[model samples]
Target: MATDTTTTAPARPPGTVSWWRRPWIAPLAIVTAVFLATALPRYVGLDPARSLVPTDRGPAFYPALVTHIFTGSVMLSAAVLQLWPWLRAHHPRVHRWSGRVYVASAIPTSIAALVVAQFPSGGVAQQVANTFLGVLLLTFTLLGYRAVRQRRFADHREWMVRSTALAFSIVTNRFWSTVLIAAYAPGALTDPDIGFGSPEIEGAAVASAWVSWIVNLMFAEWWIHRKPKRRSRVR
Candidate 1:
C-alpha cells in the first residue's frame, strides 16, 4: 500500500481581498465605466453641432476632436479592463487583446489631443497644461510598449501605470472642474446667467486642466514607490 502525499493549496480567507489586489483599482474601474457612459453621449452621435467648435479651429479641428473622443473612449474602456488583476491572471489572452486595443487607441487619441490642445478654450495656461499632458501621455505609452518589446515587464507595468493614470485623468478633470466651478462661481448652479462659459467658471476649468493630471500622477508615483512589506521567515 502506498501513502498519498498530495498537497493542496490553502483557500483564501472569506470576505477578504488578496494582498495582490489593489483596493483602489476596482472602484476606479467602476467609476470610469459609469462616468464614461454618462459624459460621452454627445460624441456617440458624431454630431459636429454638439461639439461647439470655435470657428477659427476650421473644419479639420472638429473631425480631429471627434476622433480624439471616439478613440479615447475606447482607450478608457480598454484601460478599465486592462487594470483588473483577475482578468490579467486568469485570462491572459483577454489581457493581451485589451492591451493591444489600449495601445492602438492611445496613439491616435494622443495625437488628436495634441492637435486639439493648441486651440484651448480656457486660457493660455490651460492650453499649455493640456499640451504638456498630451506629450507625457504619448511618451509614457510608447515607453511602456518599448519596455514590453525589450522583455522588461516590470518597467512595462510601471510605464503603463503612468500612461493609464494620465489617460484616466479626464475623469478627475471633470470632478475637479465641478468643484472649482462651484467654488469660483457662487450660485452657479442656481443662476442661469452664470453659464458654463462665464469667466469665473472658465478660470476654474483652466485650473482643473492642470490640477487633475498632476494630482493623478502624484498618486501614481506614490503607488509605484510604495515599500513592499517583508515576509517574516517562518522556522
Candidate 2:
C-alpha cells in the first residue's frame, strides 16, 4: 500500500492581517507622507493661523488643538513603527514599547479631536462627523491594546489595523476633498468668483469628513479578511 506523506502548510486565520500588509508599502507610505508633509508645517510651529481654524475660536481652542497635534504626531509615528513586521519579528521588545506609546498617546489625542470638532469651520455636519470619528479612534485603539494584553495577537492586529485606518482618515479626507473641490470650486476658481456656492462646498466637505473614516474602515476590513481560510476535503 502507498501512503501519502506530503504535508500542507496551515492556513492563515480568517479576519486578520493580509499577506501584503506592511508600513513601507506604497499605499500606507504615501498616505503617511502626505499627512506629515501637510500637518507638521502648519501645527508644529507656534502660530495660531497655522491651525486654519476661524480666529473666533476661543483662546482655549489653540492650546487644545496644539496638544492634540503633538500627541497625535507621537501616536501616528509609533503606530507606523508598530506596523513594521521586521521590528515585531526580530525585536519584539521595541515593538511592545512602541505599542504602549501609541495607545497611551492616541487616547488623549482622540479626546482632543472631539473637543476641536465642536467648532468646525466646515459647519455642523463636519462637526458631527468628526466627533464620531474621534469616538471610533478612541474605541478601536483601546480595544486593540486590550486584545494584545489578552494574548490574542490576531485580534490585536485586526483592531490596531482598523484603528490605524481611522487615524489616517485625515489623509483620506483630503483625498476626497481633492476630488470633490474641483466640482465645488468652479465659481471660486473663476475670475469673477460669483455664485461661489459656499453652501455646496460645505456640504461636500461634510460628506468627505463622514466618508473618510467610514471608507477607511471598510477597506481595512477587506484587507484584514483578504487572507482567507483554506477548505479541506474528506475521503
The candidate maximizing lDDT is: 1
Candidate 1 structure quality by residue, lDDT tens digits, 1-235: 9988876656534324464557867788788888878767877787766654443566677778888888999999999888877778778899999999999999999999888888777879989999999999999999999999999999999999999999998889878988888888878867878765679978987999999999999999998999978744433
Off by over 4 Å in 1: 1-22, 52-56, 231-235
lDDT string, candidate 2, 24-86, tens digits = 555666678678777878877778875654545776677778888888878878877787776
The CA lDDT of each predicted structure is 0.85, 0.79
lDDT of residue 54 for candidate 1:
49
Summing lDDT over every window of 10 consecutive residues in candidate 1, give the lowest-scoring window.
11-20
Task: In angstroms, give how far residue 60 of model 1 lies from its true place.
Answer: 2.6
Candidate 2 to truth, TM = 0.79
TM-score of model 1 (CA atoms): 0.86
> Which number leads on TM-score?
1
Give TM-scores for every candidate, taking all chains together and pairing residue i with residue i. 0.86, 0.79
**Model 2 ranges off by over 4 Å:** 1-27, 187-197, 227-235
